[model samples]
Target: MTITVILGAQWGDEGKGKLVDGQCQEAQLCARAAGGNNAGHLVRVNGVSYSFHLLPSGLINPTCLNFIGSGVVFHVPSFFSELAELEAKGLSAVHDRILVSDRVNVLLDLHVAVDGLEERELGDAAIGTTRRGIGPCYQTSRARTGIKMTDVFYPDLFEQKVRRLADGYQKRFGELFEYDIEAELARFNEYRETLPKYVVDGVSFMRSAQESNANIVIEGANALMLDADYGSYPFVTSSSTTLAGIIGGLTLNPKNITETVGVVKAYTTRVGAGAFKTEDTEEIGTKLQEIGREWGTSTRRRRRCGWLDLVVVKYSNSINYYTSLNLTKLDVLDTFETIKIAIAYTIGGEELDSYPADLNILNQAEVVYHEMPGWQKPTTNARTYDDLPKEARDYVEYIEKFVGVKIKYIGTGPDRDAMIQRP
Candidate 1:
């Protein structure tokens, strides 16, 4: 059972889409293990760029079977829209190879409404949600009142579930925000009817495939730093965004995993608000952002750019048990006069090599940086690591040494062929 897991190691927006698509070429099955439409994976193939939400990166490859595992919260509109876009691109046959987990929860229109309302109410205390109803949907799932894709197959059950959730939310809305629930439910039912057709039982299907020795690639959303449990606390996502999430999300054993590849950008970039140890405020940071196009795929919000934080990378490496690393966007730093990498963190006068569990400590921590000369020569034309300038190679080596992981793949450009495989 050669199962490979690919995920971001930063606060997301780490170019996971390209890495997963590249890896999917070698695997038979590629599965999206977590997150909802709130997470977006952008892939540039043959000069055309495709932005996907609620679809596995593998969908671009017609030969691979893509599975949406139980870990995700389904958003029908976004899923169908993405599918249609892919179809418009002449990849309509992809639907035949994709499957969704029956156990995955569905994100209803009301959930989106309620989530947005709640975030607005929170004001400054809000966790900087995408307002895509991801948090609310997961909350409902844990509350044992969520609607699954299977529920859509049964009209009576689906209606009953919707009514129950709507009734409860309506009462809370009045008490919490003085909003009318009856009107919201009426509108939600109308929207629900327009949802796409989906079958459940993804866990069983994946398990059977595993028994048959199918090569499965578990694609993860977000990154370790955005995980609800271990990430920058209160600012993290609603779900577990780590490799451990796959065990519960897919009901799979850790023993069945063959390899896990953690994807990290050459530098770091994060969306929303959180503790960014290596965040750059100077001209160099702006250059990286522009060159890398560091922006959120779901919200199109400009990302907060920063230098490489080895402290967080090492933390992710330990938690995800990453066997290999796919370092992307290496060419983004080619034109800079110098590149700075955060080697460690100094918290309360003590130099720490690892991330602190306490957000307070993290917020106050000072980064110990190491500056390396940037390569003036262009790397966009370099197809291999050997072809890259010496300074660029040094920067890569610095990251590999500090993070304690081998750089297996380096992305020089946005194109699929722009990736360089390290020897």
Candidate 2:
């Protein structure tokens, strides 16, 4: 295949890093198309764990080239910090192996300060952002006033842009936040000195890669429910998290996209504030959280856990047109004697077949669940589809039938090898 996409079908933490890492060996290139350091992906190989916010997980494969597409908001501090951490883990050629899009917007110190102030302004109604300045940077980029990666290479332009943005922020926030322009300029200049080797025209590179017929994998950040257009309002992340985001970010031909793998947890978990229609809030939620380690990779905040919602998955399938589904954390559901899956939403007096975009309707909607029996046995070592216990197999089949997509990959554990692949 020339291009295969691995996307988070549920909320952000769907173990996409491991899924993308597993296929990196087959890909000639792996590119991250959207989001920023606000999203985190964890990949484990040979007993060592690798976590990435800006860099592609394919960095684990020394031979596979990686790119950060223009759709991403580039955070310089996080970028260099993550690269150094990966180098310490023995991936020493990272500086040469990766390419960053020159068109990507730069995340500045002022943006982070503004983000903190904005969240504080929200008070109890905060969106629970990671405070990495992703949203503010994106807002600036859309306004056509933000500094780009290319601009930072020129000292004069970089300084002017920094001062301009800092003055605007200082005027808006008053004493609530400080904008240190000189310090920021110094740090950015140092970054510009080191970033030259990694910079490239991402759109042109992707086009050339296609012409060369090189196999590529697009790794998506965040997930469908967090998408700006389709997700719950105000609580949603700032960027596109669906397939359209991939195409827009990379400037890729949609016809070149072969397989779109939608990764979802066996149940459901979401970080930050939003309307969780199926949230457990009780013992089942606690057990699932404890077993699944439902915590944010970037924020480390405990995610709100709930039962699998076919209503949500079915909605995601319609948007992405996934070729297959990668069901992760199934083993987390192994302890439950009885597990629930949300089949539809009960709104007021009537049941709805489709997910509603309105925050008010969704928040008021009740989950109509279908109960299933758990396998209660470990599946972490299962190597084949048939190796799974009968109850476990049934749960997978139930999700498949309901979502109208094949469950081709079953993640029984966190390790790269702890999965059953169905043909």
Candidate 3:
């Protein structure tokens, strides 16, 4: 069987959830590799919209095995809360389909407290995190003082670790909150009781899947441009959001990867703080925002919208080596008389060869735009590639040619049937 990785080519919210959900139809197993509840994935199936923070998007597909990989920093409360929400939505088989990697780092209340306090301390220079304890949890993991999914299964060891972390937080943040060690231990025990059925030796599980020729689809959180090591740093997330992360998280051979589909929106949008080189704060920008409903699924913050930044996507292609592209939100641009695309970045009047990683440089870089005729006509109902307006077809062709990657799937709307798949 084949394994494919569906990743965001732009900053997070490149409509990865819909693409991942679509890909689930052919796969036996689907897994999330990085990040945590900090990332939001919205998927609409059969007219009912579902939002995911901790669960894999593949949970919508009953036959698919959904997993949270070792690279994730899972918050126990959010995990259970999300499951409850899914149950209420009638997907009652969630428990049977989902498996949690025992090696995942756990995010505790103390970590969430520290996250908010730290962001507040940063004040005007804050990175605009989700305050979901992602940064603090990863920090503790790197510091070798973090808790794992399996840690809660052992009572004495779990209590010792919680006390140590609580003491550490108090010493570091000077009363971020009243973290009662005993109460926290009681909560941990509750989580431990329910976690046994879900927790698994993930590496072994994936290896076995591979051996059994199960088609696996890895659902990546965030995007390549938000990766801590390669993205605009300090303002970036605390995890790897690239191909390397998936391989490391799942303990899979790179050769097991048959395809890598980079999901991108028709225009650019990013949440949180970072340099947005092509951001437009004008009328067109606001129109796109209104039409596209450009708001963070988790934070509900308005996303900064602008022209499609090919320079950034080209740079992302280099990083992820995408085998194909899934162009999403094409309908968002239907009302524009003319569509603008940032073909290159000019810094100090000199064209840069690649997208800059340094926040300072990126903040100053000017977008070199290329204007194209807009389709103007709505494409949301188009089920085939030939059904798109000629102008829309041309726009897609231009992007495909410039990025040097074939556009395999085109997203016309937010629903499950809103995509056009090309041969």
Candidate 4:
């Protein structure tokens, strides 16, 4: 395949990292198309666990070259910090392998601070952002007042833009927005001298790779339910998390996209605040959370757990149109006597054809679930698709039937080799 994409079909933290890492072995190029350090992907290989933020998980494969595309909101501190952590884990020649786009927006510490202030202003209505400066940085980008990665190379122009960005926010929050411009500038003064080596024009880079007929893999950030345009309104993340985002963000040709894999979790989960129709605020939610480790990879917050929502999955399929699916964390339901999958959603006793645009309607929407027998057997060590317990297989198969896409990969555990891949 010339190009392959792995994106979360559910809420974020659907274990897209391990799948991306698996595909990386065959990929000559791996790229992150959008979002920022706010998105986290965890990949475990050879007994070492690597968490990806601003960098692509493809770094795990020494033979692969990774790129951070223009659609991403870049942060200097977090980029170096994540790279250093990965290097400490024994990833060699890290500096020589990755390339970043010059058109990307530079996320500053003030952006992070502004994010916190914005959240505070919302009070009980907060969106629960990662406080990583993603939203604020994107806000500036959209406003055309943001500093680009290319701007960092020129101190005078960089300072002018930084002052412009800071002054705008400073006016908005006044005394509440606290920032030390000179200190931040001093740090960038040092960064400018060393950061240019990894910079590249993203379009030219991608064109050259395609010309060479290189196999490219894109690891999407965030998830479908968090997409800005398609997701649950103000509660969603600031960028596109769909297939279109990858194409636009990477400056990629959609026709070259050979395959798109939707990473579907065994159940539904949401971190922070949003309307969760299938949410079980009772014992079931707790058990699923405990067993599934349903915690946010990016935020580390306890996710609100629920049964598998076909309503959500089917809606995701409608948007991204996956070529295949990967049902992850199946073993989390091994101990349940019964398992539930949400089949449809309704409001005021009327069924909706698809996921609604309004959060209010969704919040009031009642979920109709299909209850079935649980496997009650261990699937953690299943050697193959057939090796999985019959009940487990049934659950996976039923999901495949409902979503109208074959489940190609099944994640039994967190290890790189613990997945069962099907033909």
Candidate 5:
């Protein structure tokens, strides 16, 4: 069996954890291919909910082997803290299945400081970053001056490298923002000592697993629309969040991938600042926010709610070549009399079939909506496509037709069993 990639098709918060968990039961190895603690995956098991930032969703399944791939950046303290919490809940065994990749970049205290300072400098123009040090770490990684998990074992070398990087950053800070640096170095060393035990060389391990025909699932953080190469620029993540990212991150061949599942919400939601075309500024948006608990899992900030955008979904499907689609949070729209789906966009009176390359264009684009009657009746009892109300089925079909992607699974609630597989 080859690897399968699972990613979000819309602006994140797409219930990727539930979809990953559902498929992980049959997977031998499950790995997180990209992103850092900036992205969160919320999973519910045995009626208890757990929000994971650095850990793979497969950890909840005992039979599966979980790996944090090299493409991720590790915040050691946060990583161990989550591990301890999961252990306290008896969710995972310590030494048996979990593995950390050696090539994974390490996030230092200085990086966090830089992130805060940069964001503060932006002020009103800030992108509303989580300030978790992800962007800075990736920047340093690209510069080839960043530290990795493998460097932790060599204290003297690591300290020297840190000193050199600190000096350069201090010089830049002094010139740009006039900030002090000695205190930052001291704080970074303190954090360095608190890192937990972890193994390296994740690529080799994954290759071996694949050689053994292990059923592997590569999970991506964020979504295609937030990808650095394809997303809304200046507001995008530093790393690749698309299907192509899996190949480079895990050192896997294209032939190793057999299926790609794109997860999306029934409605659209985004945290922080960006161009949101179908945003609802009315009572329905507020109602959806309350019911969905639409908030950033990492920053705890309220998320901007909007109607589903099929134009972006079509773009996502084309980029990822998604084999299946998982639609979540369908129950959040239960109270609405009518639901709107953005079928296309109009800019300067010109109809647009796909997402615009310019962020400004997206900001000014008018959404062309297709209104459908809402299924006010509860769908919690509906376990199959046949069981769903005609209106609800019609809504799903409309989306399938618009996005050119088939809906394979629908999440009716937060529970694990709430997922309905469409035949």
Candidate 6:
């Protein structure tokens, strides 16, 4: 594939890392479009487990060059921390292989401090952010007061900008915002010598990739339902986490995208606070969580579990336009006696036109579900489509039919290569 975007079809945590890692073997360029270290993609390679936060999952493929695009809100300290971890895990020659966008916004530790304070101010109405400075950093970015990637190299400009940002936050939060700007600048002074080596102009970088006809893989962080514009308002992540993000984040042309592959779990899950119409707070929900080990990779918080909601996925597809689907974590549902898929939503005995944006309306919406027979047999051993039991095949076929997209790849296990690809 020339250009493929692997996106989470629901509310993130869809095992995108393993999928991107597998695809990276054939890819020359792997780029992260949106979000920040708040998004995590875990990939296990040859018994070594890697958790990618700020970095691209493609680093595991030594031959695949990586790009952290302009649309990202990057924190330098987190970047080095993650990079050092990956290096210790035996991924060598990493420094020469990855590039950062010069136009990318910098996420400060001060911003991270502000993030928690803002959430505290909201009290019970908080958006349940990861407190990694994602929201605050993006806020500074849009307001045009944030530090750019290239600013770190200029001492005066970087210091002036950081002080201005710190002053603004200090005024907003008073003594509650206790950040050492001098220390932050000093840390940046340490980063300046090293970071410039990896910086690149995003437009020119993608232009070169296009000229080479590189097999580019765009790894989407977060998910469509958590998008800034389309997702649940105020509760959503900072950047656009859908197909629209891929273009803005990468500074790439839409025509360059050859395939938009949506990664969906056999069941659905979401993190933080939101009105989940199909949210199962009962035994089935607990079972899905415990069996699936549904904890977030970034925040380490237990994800809110529920049955697969096609209403959510279909709404996501309408925005991202997935060419095919990757039904992941099928084996997680192996022990369940029956599996359910939410087909539609209704409240007051009337069907709604689409996924209503109003959280109040969503809270009152009744999820209309369709149940299916579970394949008690484990799918972990299946190497081919026929290897799966008929029940499992039926489950896959039904999802493919319902979603209006072929399930081109089905993940049977947690390993990076434990996937069946349909040609």
Task: Give me the candidate number with maximum lDDT.
Answer: 4
- All models: lDDT? 0.82, 0.88, 0.90, 0.91, 0.83, 0.90
* Candidate 2 ranges with C-alpha deviation above 4 Å: none
Q: How close is every model to the real structure, measured as TM-score?
A: 0.93, 0.98, 0.98, 0.98, 0.94, 0.98
Model 3 ranges off by over 4 Å? none
Residue-by-residue lDDT tens digits, candidate 2, 271-324: 988888788899988988998888877888999999998888899888999999
The deviation in Å at residue 135 for candidate 6 is 0.4
The local lDDT score (0 to 100) that residue 323 gets in candidate 6 is 97
Evaluate model 6: give its TM-score: 0.98
Pairs in steric clash, model 1: 102-200, 102-201
RMSD of each: 2.5, 1.1, 1.2, 1.0, 2.4, 1.0
lDDT score for candidate 4 against the true structure? 0.91
Residue 239 lDDT (model 6):
96
Residue range 215-328, candidate 5, lDDT tens digits: 998878989988988887777788889988877888877887888889989999988777888887788788889999998777888888989988889989989999889889
Candidate 5 TM-score over all chains jointly: 0.94
Error of 4 at 203 (Å): 0.3
Any residue pairs clashing in model 6, and if so which? none
Ranking by lDDT: 4, 6, 3, 2, 5, 1
Tens digits of lDDT, candidate 6, 273-292: 97777788989999999998
Residue range 48-101, candidate 1, lDDT tens digits: 889888888888888888888898998877777788889998775876777888
